[model samples]
Target: MSNPNLLVLATGGTIAGSADSATRHDYRPGQIGIDDFLARIEELGIPANLTGKQIANIGSENMTPAIWRDLHRAAVTAIGDPVCDGIIITHGTDTVEETAFVLDVTLPTSKPVVLVGAMRPATAVGYDGLRNFANAMRVASDPDAAGRGVLVVMGDRVFAARDIRKNRTRGTDAFAGFPRDAVGLVTPSALDWFGAPWRMDETARFDFSADLPDVPVLFIHAGITPEYVDRLVTTETRGIIVCGVGEGNMPDSVRERLIRLAQGGLRVVRASRLGEGLVDREPEDDANGFVAARALNPAKARILLQLLIAAGISDPAAIQSEFDRR
Candidate 1:
């Protein structure tokens, strides 16, 4: 069979960085071109036809909803072309999970869209950017990888966009604990295997509006006053996500205010501040009338709320079901 065509969209991060020639240790983002990165892959003898585009040059923290829309549009347009087989996005490690999740929900494509990044900049010794990029390209080109929604490939592990998280700060292996079945690993023989296989649901193609809601997220801390909740509800916030303490538990005062806010027709979701475990409703826990956030973090929960608002899914029951389904 002929080789697959891969489009490498470079959004600036440490992966596309280079050391200051004068100073041996200092590095800057977007210092290297995608062509240069591809040249390294060619030198390593990876078999694929590669093309490059520089979408943006900033840390992932600086990425915005507007950029997400642009990326969605770009991926859609690229995949529509006859020569394009799939796409691999080079992104910053920070906030990469959020970007992957947004694209996974918004972009309506069965073609593989893989996101890859590196913890160490290209200037660092033993940098893994090129290897990660090559792996992502391989995953994107594989026809078996299609219809899995957006994927994140880092350190030879593949995760569904919905479940991956950056657990470590500066380690080469930063991604961990997606669903057991969603994890994709590369064996020493270079064969790809998935613990869980994901297929796109028919409901995955709902219209995604480019406009996003102005939702705010607030974290509930120990001995925290109710004023924080009050201010968020009374202010110009369209929605609110409360990062409640363990297992979606919050202080009594905060819970009371959230219940009142729900009654007032504002959207409120209860998510856990703890990293792991699912958030469920408990009657004795004072969490009545509040929607459970399930496995979503504060940022991701907010994104889901924004997407729901954009898609005109306002009912709390519907929103709760949507979160639970994934």
Candidate 2:
């Protein structure tokens, strides 16, 4: 049997970064070209006909909505290609989860989509980009990896997009799986399985092809003033997501302002700033029409909200139910 054909989309991140000295602090991210990256992967002899496209060559910290739209279009076209059996995305770790979550929710393909990244630059002494890239390709080529909505392969762990979070700053094993454990693991010869995650694939959700509206996330802190909330109302922003304290709580002042905003017809979501755990709906929160983000982080919640609003979902209860399901 012929090996599966895989398409790799490279976006600039630490994996592509270069520095003169391996120990040097100063380096340039996304300095390498996609062709070079593919050539290195070719040396692995993974038995696949691999093709690559350089979608963007900038650090993922600079990831913007415009880039996201372009990437979504590219992924749709690539996945539709007859020769492409699987897809791999080389992205920066900074916003990797957010981008993966975006693709996971929007694309309904059964073929594997794997996202990989590195903590140290390609030029660093303990560079992990090459190994991670090889493993990402391995997972992509595995038939079992299909139907697993967007997987993040880093170090030796494979995470589901809906549950993965970048947990640390410097280690190669930066990503942590949540609520449910990792969906799979990477070994020397093959991809091993733990179990499949709860996926919303083919769930008849709306697409995010249009522009995402201006929905900003406000992180809460001790005694955070409600000035920003007041301004969002003044500017007539479509929605607001508060990364509230502990179980998605805010100060009394901020909560009151947010309640006012929710009462005035603007959508509100209470998401946890904490890395793990679910934010259940509270009685007071329900009274104020605040949607609980469940287990979604602030950034992911924002993306979901943007999609819901764009689809004309204005009722908080309906929106909360969507968040609950997805």
Give the winner by lDDT.
Answer: 2
Cα deviation in Å at residue 249, candidate 2? 0.6
* lDDT values, one for every candidate: 0.78, 0.85
Which clashing pairs does model 2 show? Answer: none
Q: For this target, which candidate reaches the highest TM-score against the unseen true structure?
A: 2
Cα RMSD for predicted model 1: 2.5
Writing each residue's lDDT as its tens digit, candidate 1 over 197-254 gives 4564323445555678778888888778889877666556667888878877778888
Candidate 2 lDDT over residue span 1-326, tens digit each:
99889988889899999999999977889999999988877887778888889989999999987887877787788777877888999999999999998888888656788999888898899999988888888898886787778889999889888889888987787889776558888954778888653443453256864588778888888867989677665465889999989999989889898888889887889999998958999988779989999988898899999988888888998999989975
**lDDT against true structure, model 1:** 0.78
